[model samples]
Target chain A: MNERQKSKLVVETCLLAGKIMIENGSEMVRVTDTIDRISHNAGATEARAYVTLTGIIMSATPDMGSQVTAIDKRTFDLEKVSTVNDYSRQFAAKKISLGEFYRCLKRMDKDVKPFPFWLQMIGAFMVSATLEIVFRSNYTDFWAAGFVGMIGWCIYCLTDHYTDIRFLNEFIAAICIGFMSILLIRAGIAKSADDLIIGGLMPLVPGVPITNAVRDTLSGNLVSGPSRGIEAIMSACALGFGVAMAIKILG
Target chain B: MVNVIIFSVCVYFATIGFGLLINLPRKALNMAGIVSLIGWLVFHTVNVHMGGYLSADILGTFTVGILSIFASRYKKMPVIIFNIPALVPLVPGGQAYQVMKCLAIGNYALAKSNLIQVIFIAGGIASGFLFAEFLNQLYLRFKTYIITKKATR
Candidate 1:
C-alpha cells in the first residue's frame, strides 16, 4: 500500500482496537493506551488518541487526518480485552506484521463468542447461591437463591434481547427476583426473603461499571470518569427501584 | 476458624462463577478465585478482630489489587482479567440490598445510614485499588533506575 493508505489503515486499526476494548468493559486509561501502542508500533509518529465512555477519536500526523468511532453498546467480556492486549504486545515485539495484526483483530471482532446461554445461567446460579453463604454466613436459603437467581438472569437476558431501552432489563429482572423470593418465602421453601433477594440480585448488580468508574476517575480520565459514574448510579437506582416497587406492592 | 474456612470456600466458588459470567479467559479463572479467596481471608480476619467493615474492605481490596497484578504477569493476561472478578467478594452488594429493603419498609433513618455505609465501602475499594496501582508504579520506576545505573557503571 502507498504511504497515505498505510497511514489510514494504521489509524483504522487503532480505532478498531479501542472500540473492542471499550465495548468489552476496559477502563479508559487502558483503552487509550492500547490505541496509542497499536499506532506507535505501526510506525505512526506523534500518534494520539482521546477516548471517553461513549466514543473514541484517534489521529496520527496531520496529513493522515483522524478517525472517529462511536461506541454503542457495552458489556463484560474480558477475553476480548485480553486477546487484544496480547496481539498488541506481539505486534510491538515484531512477531507479527501490521497487516497480519489488523486482519487477526478484524477476524476476532467478527467472531466474538460468549459462553453458551445455559452455561451462563448456571454461572449465575452458582454465584447467587454461594455469595449468599459468603455474605450472610448461612445456607438456609441456598437452593432458593440459586433458583431465583437463575430465573432473574434468564429474564434479564431475554428482556435485553427483545428491547433496546437502557436499564429496563435490569429493572424488570430485579422485580422478578424480589417477587420470586417473596413467593418462595411464603411457600416455605426459603426461611428468609432477605437472603434470597440479595443473592438473586447479585447477578444483575452494577459491579463492573462501579469498579470501572472508580478506576477511570482515579486514573485522571476527566470525561469518562464522571460519565461512567453516572451510568453506574443510574443502573443501581433502576435496580433498587424495581426491588422497592416489588416489596411495597407485595411485602 | 471453621466459619472462616467456609466463607473462604464460598468466596472462591462465587468468584469463579462471576468470572465465568463475565467471560474471563479460562486460563485465568482458577487464579482469579485464589486472588479473591486471599482478599476475603484478610477481610474476614480484620473485620472479626478489629470490628470495622470499612478498614476491612479497603485492606481486602488492596490485597486483591496487588495479587491481581502478579496474577496477570504470571498468566500473561491483562490485569483486569483477574482484578475485576477477584474484587467480586469485596463489593457491597449485601449492603446495597439492605438500603433498598430499608427504603421499602419506610424506615428512612435506617435507609440513610445503610446508604452511607454503602458509599463508604465503595470509596474504600477505590482507594485500595489506587494505593496498589501507586505502589506498582513506584516499583517499576525504581527497577528502571537500578537497571540504568548498573548499565552506566
Candidate 2:
C-alpha cells in the first residue's frame, strides 16, 4: 500500500524475475507470472497489469524468448522490475486498459535477442539425420520412419531455440517422431523402424528432467516433480509405440 | 576417464563464455557449469555400460536434464546452452545410419528389433528418473498429508 512496502516488493520481484529469466529459456511467460505474484504486495492490479506487460513485450520484440537473455535485459535492476510488476498487477485487478503495457513490450524488444542454441542444434542435427537418410543409396521405408523425427527435430529446435524449451517439448517431439518413424518404416522404405524412431527423438532428448528429477527428489517435490518424471517416461514409451505399431501393421 | 574430465572442462569454459556474453557474473556461471558437469558425469558413468546408440541416449538425456536444473537454480545462465556439450555426443546419428542400412537390404526383423531396442533404451533412461522422482514425492506427501496434517490440526 505504502511506497516503502511497494519498493521492497518491487526489489524482490525484480530480482526473482531476473534470476528466473536468466536461467530459463522462456521470459515473457515467466515475467508475467512473476508480475502476477508480486502485484499482490504492491497494491497493484495483477491481471490488467500483466496484459499491459505482455503487450509491451510482444511489441518490443516479437520474439520475447530471444530477448530475455540479451545483454540489455541486465539493465532491469531490482527497483525498476519491481515497480513494473506491481504496476501491472494493480492495473489488472482494477480492470484497467493496458495500452501502456503493449507500448512497453514493443519498446523492450529493440533490446531483444532470441536464444539460438536450440534452433542451431536441432537444425544442424535434423539436417544431419535427414541428409543421412535421404542420401541412403537404396530407397526404402526406413527413411519414411525417420521423416517424422526430422519434423519433430525442426519443431523442437524452433520451440527450444526461442522459447522456454520445456520438458513437454522433449516429450512431444519424441512421440511425434516415434509415431512417424513407424509409419514410414512399415511402408517398407527399408529403413529400420526403431532406428528412425530413435533418431526422430533426438530433439526431445532430456536436458532438464534428469536434473529436476534428482533435484526435486533432493528438495522434496516428489509428487509434483516426479509426476513430471513419469510423464516423461510414458511419453517416451508412447513415442516408441507409435512407431512400433506402424511397423507391425506393415508386417 | 581423462577424456571425460577434459571434455567437461571445455564444456564448462564454453558455457561460462556464453554466460559472460549475457552479462552474468563469473561466480554464477561457473557454479552452473559445475552442477551441470556433475550431472553429466553421473549419466555418462551410469549409462556407459549400454552399447552404442543406447549408451548415447541414456547419457545425453541424463546429462542434459541435470545441467538444466543447475542453470535454473543459478538464475543467471541460459539452461539450454549449458546443455550443449552434454547432448552433442548422443545425437543418435550412428544408430540411425546403421538401422537404415539394415532395412534397405530388407532386414525387416532386424530393423524391427533394433527399433524396439533403441526405443526401449531411451525409454529406460526416463524410467530411471521416474523411479527416483516418484519415491521422493510419495515420501514427501506422505509426511505432509498424514503426519504434518495431524500435527498442524
Candidate 3:
C-alpha cells in the first residue's frame, strides 16, 4: 500500500477500534488513550479522539491529508471491551504489526462468542439467590429470590432478543420479577415479598453505569459524565416502572 | 462473628454471578469476586461501627480503587474489569429502587428523601475513587523523582 493508502487504513482502523471500545462501555480516558496510541504508532502525523456515551469522533492526519470518522452506535458488552483493551496493549507494545492489527480487529469483530443464554440465566439465578443472603433474608425468602431471579432473567433474555423498544426489556423484566416475588409470598414460600423482589432486582440494577459515570466525572470528562448519570437514572426508572405496574396490577 | 463470615461468603458468590452477567474476562472473574468480598466486608464493618453509610462507601471504594491498581498490574488486565464489578453491590441500588417505588406510589416525600440519599451515596463513592487515584498518582510521581535523583548521585 502507498503512504496515502496506509495512512487511510490506519485512520480507519483507529476509528473502528474506538467504536468497539466505546460501544462496549469503556471509559472515555481508555478509549481516547488507546485510539491515540494506535494511530501514532501506526505512523499518523497526529491523532485525536473524542468519545461520548452515544458516539465517537476521531481524526488522524497523515502525509496526504487529514481524515475524520464518527460512529453513532452504543451497546454494552464488557467482554468485548476487555478483548479490545488487551489487543490495544499488544499493538502498542509493537508485538503486532499494522496488518496483524487489522486482521486481529476483524477477527475480533467476527469471533468472540458471548456466553450461552442458559449460563447467563444460571448466573442470574445465583445472583438473586445469593443477594437474599446479602440482604440477610431467611431461607424461605432465599429460595423465593432464587426462583424469582431465574424466571426474571429468562424473561429479560427473551424480551431483549424479541424486542427493539428502548428500555422495554428492563421494564418487562422488572414486572416479571415483581409479579413472581408477590406470587411466592402469596403461596407462603417467601415471608417477605419486598425482600424477595429486591433480591430479584439485583441482576437488573444499573450499578456499572453509575460507577462509570462517577469515574468519568471525577476524571474531568464533564459532558460524558452527566450524560451517563442520566442514563443510569433512566435505566433505574425503567426497572422501577415495570415493578410498579406489576404491583398496581397484582394488588 | 459468624454473621460476618456469612456476609463475606454470600457476597463472594453474588459478585461472581455479577461478574458473569457483565461477561468479565475469565481470568478476572475469581479476582473480581475476591475484590467484591473485601469491599463489602469493609463497608459492612465500617457502617456497623461508624453508623454512617457515606463514610462506609468512601472507605469501601478507596480500598477497591487501591486494590484494583495492584490487580491491574499483577494480572495484566484493565482495571475496569476489577473495579466495576467490585463496586457493584455498593451502588445504592436499593435507594434508587426506593426512589422509583415511592414516586410510582405517589409518595412524594419519601421519593424526595430517597433521591437525596442516592445522590449523597453516589457522590461519596465518586470521591472515594478520586482520592485513591490522586494518591496513587502522587506516589508514582514521587517514586520517579527519587529514582532519577538517586541515579544522578
All DockQ scores? 0.82, 0.08, 0.67
lDDT (Cα, tens digit) per residue for candidate 3, span A51-141: 7666666556523544445545455677788888778888888888888877888788567776777788778878888877777546657
Segments of candidate 2 deviating more than 4 angstroms: A1-148, A154-191, B1-153
On a 0 to 1 DockQ scale, where is model 3? Answer: 0.67
lDDT of 2 by residue, A8-45 (tens): 44444444443434233222334545655544434444
Clashing pairs in 3: none
Tens digit per residue, CA lDDT, model 1, A150-219:
9999999999999999999999999999999999989988998888988898877777788888889999
A192 in model 1: Cα distance from truth in Å? 0.3
Q: What share of the true interface contacts does each candidate keep?
A: 0.79, 0.02, 0.62
In the range B17-54, model 2's lDDT, one tens digit per residue, is 33432333333545645654565455556655654545
lDDT of 1 at A68: 91
Error of 2 at A211 (Å): 2.2
lDDT of each: 0.88, 0.44, 0.80
Model 1 chain B weakest lDDT span, ten residues long: B79-88
Candidate 1 vs candidate 2, DockQ winner: 1
Candidate 2 lDDT: 0.44
Alpha-carbon lDDT of model 1: 0.88
